[model samples]
Target: MACFHPLTMMLTLVLAARLAAAVPFKNESYPLTTVPGERPWNPIEPLQQRLAYINATAMAVSWNTYTSLPDEEAVVYFGTDAWELDRTAPSRQSTFETSRTFSHHAILSGLEPGTEYHYRVAHTNCFGCSTIPTYSFTTALPAGDCTPYAVAIVADMGLMGPDGLTNSTGKGAGGALLDNETNTIQSMVQSLDAYEHIVHIGDLAYADYFLKASTQGFYGADNVLTNATSIVENYERLNEAWYDQITPLTSQRPYMVAVGNHESNCNNGGVKDKVNNISYTAQICMPGQTNFTAYAEHWNMPGRPGPSQNFWYSYDVGMVHYVVLSFETDLGEGLYGPDEVGGTGKQMSGPRGKTGEQIEWLRQDLAKVDRKKTPWVLAFGHRPWYVGIADAVCEPCRLAFEGILYENNVDLVLTGHDHVYSRSVPMFNHTADPAGYDNPRAPTYITNGLGGHYDGLDVLDSPLPANVAHGIDGVYGWSRLTFANATHMRHEFVAARNSSVLDEFWLVRAREEGTCVDGEEGHTGKDNGKGHGKGGKKDKRDVLARLDE
Candidate 1:
């Protein structure tokens, strides 16, 4: 038997008590402004990268300020080629829930397409602070043009550390860590010359300090399990670091995004249901706010028909009609019953008599896809309707949206959430509708959720579903889509660690005049003027009839 000293025993008892009383979010500090030199007057310069709405000939920029100054206003100065010192866009200022931090968003409109513009963001009253450096961005190619472009897709991108422990600023998980995932995609940054659009499916900056501590075995993981104040403070810190990491690349291109489960907390985007992500709503500001508040506050996205800003929306880039949606809300994840492990009830909101709003929205959106005009209709969301993972399957999600995707003849359906890279054989209704590479009859489903997060990666099922073509896990990577032209497009998975091309395939558009065309040309996926594609007066009233039954 070993004898313990009285002092040692006392210390051990104290430690045990402390651990036992640890709260999930119990920070005593009121405001945690971690950004160096973050002043209430000057504030931290807009850290998040600028997001572009190319179709509207405008760009939206946002940043965080520690405190608000009386009569203080946020402004962005811009001009073609150089800052003409003439044109200015005033910002709409508002405060977030995390702290007294003020958020500012300014939209610079009336710009020309495919043209260069220089700009700077600043406080209207900060007289002594040096002006923010000028950044340049070129507007996207004019809409309706048969121009060639590429889109880079990344998801679940969490904190990046330099020594696998600390980030560029020598901070670890508890601070503004580096985005190694972004570092891995540096080549994609270089490829930016060709890829102008960057789309993040979901799960941006896993700063869930307020939720609970992460036990996924990563050091300095910013999960403060004891303090609420520290939680918000650490959140702002991690967020600032995240914005800084992507600023360099995003400043030059358009960064589009979709919401995921992580953003479902505490009024984040005005939501507090089965999923509660208060941080997401407070952080991201998009176009549609009456329903989704935070998102509406930040982004000036195009094609917002009202109601929900980040819920579901559509826009056209070059020859592609891009649809962005929210799976957490769109799939009725919050409306399910018992909230138990497996026992569930009602996948969507409202009774079963009528199709839900999202389903109806989808039907109308898909019915309007004029292949001849845009050539390809690509739909993206955070969660995948069809995925083959041992513990991450969402059958209800499939039941919710797969039918609409198939009925619409969408070319490619991209999703993230499974934390792995997977491509399904052109699939429709649980069968492998062989449309391999060229003219896929069924939309090809690809999951690129391996964006390197501390929560770890997902495992693959021993035997994949019959419709799954390829699947890989235990790797970090992103997906790339190259719109070769109106008729052909290429998709590839690039390993982030080394920028290696992991998987590649080509999706050919089925033209009305041909059997299965592979080369680029006009009339990519036109409506054929038969009430199917475009300009068809096919009674759209039946949009929800299928769902009702």
Candidate 2:
């Protein structure tokens, strides 16, 4: 037996405690200024300003205001130049049952494709007008235009410190650390010009885990729900903080999003009736806690004729046709259906039934794609069929939409649910394509869920599936998709801490009128046939150099 000194033991214990200490949830809100005025009544300045692509000639700008303004006052003023604002579009204000603030959205239309426009949101009543600082965003390029562009892909990203560092040490119930977000956000900001827009597939803020703490346990520990007001306020504040954190990027670029499990429900553990064990009730949940109340209220995605436009929609940017799907509900067959998982206990039955609506819509959407115009077709959603963790694999989702996607010859599938970065060979039905990425028969899958979140990071299981070409864990990062030309596209997984390229791959396919171009000849895919290893040496150097400049 070995005896340890008292001082040594005490020091070791203190260090262990520090490592395991849960960082308290910060309730800091965006430092928004009130409208400039000496009048007794002044509306709160707009916060969480964001942009979404409505069409080639239109874009939707949304923001949050704590004080209610008259309907006539909500509007957006815009023009080609920041000083000469000439056009105005009325905005609609909306709020949820438990919301403390109102959300306003205004659509700016009749704009030229690929043209930059400066805009400001404000209350423009007859008395006076108060406006936020002007921001600019360039409209999307015309459809069918094979212009070279890149889009930053992120998922499961959460709030970071003001200086772009990890703010929380508490690993939530899922065991994911709330670190690496600073790296991810800083990298994106540094290379803002590198991508046209950002596609955040799912798990935006993780506000659902508002009660996560070391003492209370990560998940919704039943005891913490006693104070309903506190729960609601914290949840809302966390969301506000997260949006404020991303405003630097989102305000400047179009931030597209999809629903993830975190967005599905608030404190998902519901209380079940012990007698029958057949029904459950959300005792402490607010109106925004159940279903996707917060998500739908926050974002005004492109219009689609259905219960909600945010659930499913399609848009085109440059040479890529992008489709956003819903894994939480409306999938033909899955754990998440109407009133199943995060639902409000109300069925979404209408022209399109609950179960098969999204799937049917997807089939129609994919069938309408014209290969010649937009040569690359990419679909993004929250849950993933293939991931590093075996138990996290969404078999139901795979079964629901795999056949249609494979049949349509989709080019790429992007998802983020398992909290890791992974890329697969272009294959189908659990088999790797022998031809590799060069004109493969099936769509390649990239699971980019490693965007920083409260859960530290998922542990990868040994003996990865056969189809996975590369998979990485314990790194906070995002993926970048560069559509170089009609027949060539490149995917790179970038480490958030240093903007280093952890993995690189190019999808090569011959279009009807063009052959695949060897963009980076030697660095076609992962190095030495292994995943997450450093590759694309010259390209990585160029990216770092650009960041320095």
Candidate 3:
């Protein structure tokens, strides 16, 4: 028999203990609250109803049904009045083989901008369809409209209840668990009037985490079953629970999202195999787990034609242009590539070749923005380029898209992944702009991933980076961005528990004439530096007329 050294034996035991501690065990006894009246009266009853913006004149409505319906029967009826739904639009149905239910979607088009419309989703073939209650949503303001609007930003939010809290403490990053949701959800519900839409950067639900724990026997010996049938039912319940939890908000506003590492693989741990010594895992991955199947099928974003369309897209809301990018894949070599998870080579989304397609698309999109019409450009993704945690910082993502964003003068960039909140001064290449928030030349970066989730908070690096303006890890909260006008925007980080303002700042920029100075053809006048009236007020009508050329 081989004898091991005492020191080696001691180290081996310590490593094992840490590994066991890192694995989260399921609390089977924790009570999960059922959504009021969520039990379907029929197999075709819709749940998890959500809305997304397609354009100024259109909005997309989607919901989940236990059973698939005929394409012609998946329809929405709508009108401006709640009593009479005078319009109808046919819908399309889709589902992943790994999913137990079908998703139905329909677009309400020819809508008036900024007008509230009441609608109801139903299957015409079903009996007593009129009993479905009516829901209402407002269309986005037309581009070039300088009306003020606010948007809510959240990330890393998991399913409400015990699943979202730390198992040992039975609490979140904030304090005691108040109800099913973290402070973020309660806060948003209380201040519904504060924002018109919600931008969920990524990690919508912890479904994959649940699946991982169940397959690894963390849920209990009886929950160790990982068959295809078990996996499908596992995700179905988790997805429905999360979507139902947020229906109060998503049903009323456009719930925009981007892809995160949690959305990449089934196990939510990373890839399972190895390529040339680099490890990747596909051990428990099922059909719908990879390729963002569930996320893509559930959402119908207005994405341009490309393999990464659902992952990367842009939309204009009032005076701000919002661009969503994927930090999980299509980002060429280095960490955050398809073959890695959270920068660790231990797990991955497998070998997805980099085509540089996303970056190229970003370039074209940013190049086409006419700043004279929409003065503020905000880009958001799942991972952060500037954060307090070193490991959480994605240098590869910064290398890929920072130059283009800076060149185009993107006003702000939002990201989540660190589970802590940190804001950086307007910076490029790690250097803070001397002008700061006052007409800065570079984008101001913020990591607002503190929307409470199962993993709890991430510890920030001591001696925080010089560029970080504000950093917090103890509290669970979300940020609100108010596009006050063409020249002024305000951002506030609000505490989830009490709805207190934790941090606030104003980003001010002068509306320069010929702001189309980014080399887009049309106006050739130089910046007079006197603000809007320097050449004459160029309103929406003037911008629209020029675009008609």
Candidate 4:
């Protein structure tokens, strides 16, 4: 990181380090005016990394103005090209809900798909304050069957640039924080990205603050039992340090994301004790609002969960049907979910019924998927029902939907909860389908929980799933899912250790047509669907077990 004032270049466009280093003087003549600094303007929330939305006829921009700036209008300049600071889309910042952060949304209509637009933000008037740069995002691709070269898959990126906790172990040149899940995200702050679209598997920044009484402002953890309170105050002081890590990468790419268990109130004993994080829901300028307001405001993600009836939505992205489901609660957990457990000393609930809803939605969603319209059906959630890791407390819970998906011929399953990467064989009933080798068998499964988390790496309690050719661990990395034409897709593990491909392989959907991920059989003599990956080879493990028999 170096600094040199250009004797040749003028100050019209100052590129100052985001740190507190004296901002390179642009001009004393045009002192930054408007947006009174009396109340902190601060870094905007739900920071956009790489926005990869579709040609939404109407796209909105929104935010919060903190409690002190009681009166102001939320404005956005629009149009496809930069420079011409014309087109105005204005919405008054309405003072709503409780708390100090004033939420806002401004939906701009008539935006063309696959096109870029630039805009600026202001409260009092669009002047003087550090000018919100000319940011542009490409809307989601049109709804049809087409193919893009590559898509980056990253999980557990909770809006921080660093991994928070520091530890040194075995990352070749010694371990740096990036060594274990570095924020080398290819989104935000760039001239478009090589990846047309990206998917953030889960666990976004633990946003729970206004001007969180910390040096940086906010912490990047989930807002579960803690709400957005200061219990994680120490985490807040880390904003400056973390933001310095990822924004550069994510801002450059068009990103699609999945929710992690940490984003909402997973630990609260009572229902009301739980809060819907505005940080996890809502897009700026949209009329809707929520608990994780910061997330909804800044990221402007669509179809979030909760009483808002927003979570678990799907869209089309060039030859693929991108389905995002919420496993944090939508799927279910006896102690933490579904039926609303006991309210006393211990809270316990059966599987959340959203599974059934999503199951039905999946049926309808997939039913609507005319192969001609969107050829590849790719579904993802935060929790990976089948992983290599084992829990000492209890056997890991397998997803109830694996059976449904297998029966439906899903092309791929992607997840992020486990903080390490693990890829399973083309399995149906927890065993590899030798049929996986031919044209028309079972769907393929890819696990890339390695995008980076402080939880450390995960080791398999079981053996490799049949033909799992490649795997890596003890290092941090992100997954890249590359689509090669219609019938072929490749998964590569990009290690932050050195940005190298730790593990890479191809999944030929046209090659394995009838395969399923139903899990292995149990003593009950029925397909219990528990994640039991095959019993060795040769004389034992049955191919596609249940189906083979």
Best by lDDT: 3
Residue-wise C-alpha lDDT for candidate 3, range 46-161, written one tens digit per residue: 67788999887799999878788898887888877666788998888889868767889898998876667778877777545323356777777666766556789999876665
Superior by TM-score: candidate 1 or candidate 3: 3
Candidate 2 achieves a global lDDT of: 0.68
| Model 2 stretches astray by more than 4 angstroms | 1-43, 126-131, 162-168, 171-181, 214-225, 270-282, 333-353, 514-549
Identify the runs in model 1 with alpha carbons over 4 angstroms from their true place. 1-44, 54-56, 69-72, 83-85, 128-131, 162-191, 209-225, 266-298, 303-307, 332-355, 513-549
Q: Could you tally the backbone clashes for each prediction?
A: 28, 6, 10, 68
Per-residue lDDT for 1-549 in model 4, tens only?
011124312222442222223211111222121111112334332222234353334554544444434333455666655556467766544443333345454556676543455555444432344333455554544444232445677777543333332343222122235433333342222212335556777665533221221112212343223333433332332322233244334343445556554444222222221133223221121111223232333344454433323246677754567877655543433323221233221223223344356556666776776555456778787776555563411112244557666776778888776666777666666677676634445666676766543334565555644455445666667776665545666677876545667777667756233221111111111111222211112112332131122
Q: Root-mean-square deviation of each candidate, in angstroms?
A: 15.3, 12.5, 14.6, 13.8
The lDDT ranking, best first, is 3, 2, 1, 4
Question: If both were scored by TM-score, which would come out higher, candidate 2 or candidate 3?
Answer: 3
Per-candidate TM equals: 0.72, 0.79, 0.81, 0.67
The weakest ten consecutive residues by lDDT in model 2 span 31-40
- Candidate with better TM-score, 1 vs 2: 2
lDDT of each structure?
A: 0.56, 0.68, 0.70, 0.46
Judging by lDDT, tell me the better candidate of 1 and 2: 2
Residue 186 lDDT (model 1): 47
